[model samples]
Target: MRLTAEQIASFHEDGFLVLQDWFTPDEVDLLRTETYHEFGNDQPGRILEKNGAVRTVFAAHKSNDVFSRLTRLQKMAEPAAQLLGDEVYVHQFKINAKLGLDGDQWEWHQDYLYWLKEDAMPTPNVLSAVVFLNTVDDFNGPLLLIPGSQKMGTIDLDVEKKYQQLDVAESWKPTLTADLKYKISKRTLIRALENSRIVAAKGTPGFVVFFHGNTLHASAGNLSPVDRLSVFISYNTVANALQPIANPRPTFISERDFTPIAALPDDALLAPRNGHSSPQREQLASLAG
Candidate 1:
């Protein structure tokens, strides 16, 4: 769906926008099924927890048809293009399955920091579309965003202690171990946002949240009984593709494809089963099959 002028303004001001029921129930169900059935630990970019539960599955769009289409939908891509002010391409695709107890904490940091430091992304011309496959609420460990932080530019290293770009380029790799602390000083983050109220990224199934690439955000470990599943699709402007680097990450982490995204029809995911002639019949079929 096309974004409203007000929505765009809000995003620029707050660094994020939440869309309720962006996808229909049938669509959410179809995608949720794919999340559990289509992913496995054998993949190159998969990261598991200490208990061996899948924490993040990267590059699902490249392998799964449903996800491949979902990421390119005009509902998401169109708005991303408007925000980036250029044609967009997929930079990263991942699914986070924060299982009941295995859902680990993701430290406070901006996504642009990761893309800039490790992935060799030149500018902050990227954004992420987060879709809730399962309900996200306070107890389930919703993502937290510090509003208006994107306007501060990239929050990072001290000038004197800065890593030489060449030295950092040759040696550093993206690792989740202390990932949150690595991007920014956790203690410093606490002090900077001491006056700001945190926004919990909670929503129902089919709900979507879009945040700027440089938005300061984090998620807590799941302590609730039920699991939380969220789909994150990142879009980078084709002109802002990865820059030359001394060492590069796997293609799954930083996609090599710079093709402009083409969106499917709005109803593509909610389309009926073949041979279903009536709307009622289609509705029942979606629920049954």
Candidate 2:
């Protein structure tokens, strides 16, 4: 599950890395089933688009047993600790749901901007480990990343001016929507493209992508009749945990606990569904009971 020296170097240079089929098909099926259970529920973390389709579900790890175990997967947490070179904790965990035909576009932006402004994060030493729950293709709204954009440092964005017309009381909610409040302007995006090119992250259900917190990325709306569901777990170095800020975002979006993650065994996900028997054996026993 550990990354090689060459792979680490590539991540440092490109600000992102892709690991194909990181999860088995059976494990993905289990995760996919758990993810769908979060939607259309009463949880305050569930966010919806203007079209009434689900956009994101925050803190699934906190509510579901399967996702709670997912947070500590060795394949994800180990590499994150290696990349950050420090003990890492969960900063935020959510699943982005871009439903078929009803999905909306996400504007280009750096994730660290929100963390810096909202949570008072001191540095850009955080990264996101994402797991694709469905096949992501050109027609299904795959993520678009700008190579080497993380090295640009934080981009100066005028977030306050764009949402000046809206009420401050509700301004925080808009930032999580399809049209991001802290969006990178076209002028700045053009300047970025001059130095780096955009690449589409297309893969199957088990695909995983790790990107730096400062990486500039976005995605178009889903045009085909397929859903694009991906799980995002943002890990921040313990040394770079957020400083206190007034009017902090909801706990679901920004985790309050700063405990370092202790990864489970590599085969944790593929373990038997029951305590000490195969899934079929457990099912038969239940019938006998």
Candidate 3:
């Protein structure tokens, strides 16, 4: 579960590292099933696209058994701790879905922007553990990331003008939508593109990509007939937890707990159902019952 020195160096250079088949197919099937179960709930955390398709479901780890175990899996937690060089806690957990033909485009932006502005996060000592729940290809919307873009640090933007209509109290919602409030301007993107190339994250259901928090990323609308679903678990260094904002976002969006996450056993997710083998087995049995 630990990352190699070469993989760590590559992540530092490119701001991302992809591990194909990081999870087994059986584990992926379990994750996909749990994702759909959470998606059917009528909760404020379930964001929808303009076309009425499910967009993103936030904080499922709090309510779903499978996702809760996923956050603590050794394979998922160890690398994040190694990369950040500190004990980490889950800052945000969500399932981002691109439904076939109905999914919308996400504009170019860094994931850290929302944390910087809304949560008052001090530094970018964070990373996202993205697990592919479905097969991703060119036809289906795949995440696009610029190589080494995280070294640019925080890109400046005029927030007042971009979100002039909404007050500061109400601006956090728009920033999470398709039309993001903190979008990277075309001129800035063009300049960055001059030095960096776009990488399409294409892989199968078990693929996992761990990207730096400040990495510039986005995705196109799904054009194919298949849906693309991915889990994004934002892991932040426990030392650099939020500093408190006046109008903080909901718990689902910005987790309030600063407790460092303890990694469960490697087989926590797919442990045998014979019982007494995994700490997660009791929860899974409860859900199944």
Model 2, span 1-289: residue lDDT tens: 8999998888889999999999999999999888888886768888899978999999988877678778787798989999999988889999998999988999999999999987899999999999998999999899999999999999867766657787656667877898787879888899889978999999889999999999999999999998899999999999998998888888899987898887776666655653577765454335323
What C-alpha lDDT do the candidate models reach, one value each? 0.80, 0.87, 0.88
| Candidate 3 wrong stretches, greater than 4 Å | 160-162, 167-169, 272-289
lDDT of 2: 0.87
Most accurate candidate by TM-score: 3
Off by over 4 Å in 2: 160-169, 272-289
Q: Model 3, range 201-267, lDDT digits (tens) per residue?
A: 9988999999999999999999998989899999999999999778798889999899988777767
C-alpha displacement of 283 in model 2, angstroms? 23
- In terms of lDDT, the best-performing candidate is 3
Global local distance difference test of model 3: 0.88
Error of 2 at 148 (Å): 0.2
TM-score ranking from best candidate downward: 3, 2, 1
Mind giving the per-residue lDDT tens digits that candidate 1 earns over 195-228?
A: 6668998878989999999888888889998989
